[model samples]
Target: MASESSPSDPAAWLALLDWRRQISALYARVRELRDSDPPAAHALWQAERNRLFRAHSQSPLLPEARADFVSLPCWPYDPALAFSAPVEFLPLERLDIPSSTGQAMPLVRFGRVELPVGTLDVYWIDVYGGGVFLPFRDAGSGHESYGGGRYLLDTAKSADLGSAPGGALVLDFNFAFHPSCFYDPRWSCPLAPPRNVLDVAVRAGERAS
Candidate 1:
């Protein structure tokens, strides 16, 4: 352990994140203008994309302890997969959640597959009542995939997910990985949407594969 003494104080950690986020926010701005100005936006666009690559890859963002994946029921709910395999994200348009107010993200299938199991990334991101927020299920729910569809990426709070690109970026299942809940059940997780469920087994990414 690096001694809780080093600038590991909560405030320091927050400050570092805040600084990094300012950079991330700048990238979001560039992406918003891609339609109007392709060339100019592309530069800032690439810069921002690189930053995100580093946020999860370069920077020591998640602590080793928190980053460690544990089977559900033993630890607090941590919804992120520590992926050893690498896959590029396939972008898709934002689809709305069937019954609720949420965005649908398309994810392209990876690895060796049998049929055309399309990849569309979608996220139903909200809940009734205060203090309640989560993602939902769809056609691909349960089965070969996670019984509780993969959790969306969160930047706000661990549970609070962020908005998708203007239909620009959506991560694939090879990268879909697992949520913090898979490691520890003490932590709650979002249930996949009924519409999201699918019959064919999605043999890729994180499951028994």
Candidate 2:
């Protein structure tokens, strides 16, 4: 049976709400820039990026943006490495996951799932002109989110980002991971496609406490 949780808990409930708020803010900022202005979108993206790397959502009073960028957690990534090539590269063409909703790239068995998995190539972060980053999740929904078992897609290593070469974008579910919410709820994360949902426990990455 299911039991109720407290809204005042220093951990569980409060953490959940805090996570929602961070995601909400990230989503809100992104929403405002959809068609507003590319430049504005870029700026907001940078700010959101700052929040993701730096400060987290205040768990107590639903905190507000503190110091210009001081209160924020400094991004661990180096701007110079944003365009660096991945250590290694591989090609994928199929993703094996659930996708009754959007487009699904087929793939062979991923993670512990004896079955195949599918990947949705919607949000691709262009790390460099030759490589792109695609974050995703799989069967392990709540068990392991922060790690969510994600992987990167690179063009320098694989075929071109386009359909010119023999590179496929099929993602590996074994790498599914959790979002910033796992470490700190002061961050927003994208939702995993329904097709990506798994019915079993994914014992990788950070677990909810």
Candidate 3:
């Protein structure tokens, strides 16, 4: 079963709602500017994300860390690392991926996207209100990025970039971000499985701080 915030902490739930709203709004603007002005879009994303992490009530940063938080460390945006790829549908297979908080996430492997870097499995969250969930690990993992992985798209939380004219998903490494668990262990986050590990070092997104 999915977890819910404690009823006693209604303020916490409200903050969470605010955080999701801000994220959705930010991505909507990003999708509008990404095709025409990628650099500007990238700057907007980083600036807004830093703002949230530093002061937003739902920020994943620990209380002590937030006090000293300056900005999230990110690599310079590389236009070449972005692509629009078609999803190759596969026979759905149920899988339970282990999480940082030790909760297993039930997902359905439904498709794959072939990119210049490598192919990555695309999954559906499988539970009610299922959404696209694409997490990946690259050569830079554990060195340049988080050890577990980074998420490219987690539509459940509205982290989607608009699709291309052909309906291909816009996979932009520049917007890739580490999961909340990377900042605080209290968050439960599903990681990339072996099939989603890329051989190339996708040096174009949020980096290890």
TM-score of each: 0.35, 0.29, 0.96
Off by over 4 Å in 2: 1-115, 118-139, 144-165, 200-209
Which candidate, 1 or 2, would have the higher lDDT against the true structure? 1
Model 2 weakest 10-residue run by lDDT: 79-88
- Give the total clashing residue pairs for model 3: 0
List, residue by residue over 1-209, the lDDT tens digit for candidate 3: 12433646768888888999999999999999998999999999999999999999888889899988889998898989989999999999999998877788999999999999999999999888889999999999998999899999999988999899989999999999999988887778888898999999999889996
Best by TM-score: 3
By summed lDDT, the worst window of 10 consecutive residues in model 3 runs over 1-10
The TM-score-based order of candidates, best leading, equals 3, 1, 2
Predicted structure 2: clash tally = 36
Tens-digit lDDT track of model 2 for 33-59: 533443453345456544644554433
For model 1, the superposed segments whose C-alpha errors exceed 4 Å read: 1-121, 127-145, 152-167
Give the Cα-based TM-score of candidate 1 against the true structure.
Answer: 0.35
Best by lDDT: 3
On the 0 to 100 scale, the lDDT of residue 42 in model 2 is: 37
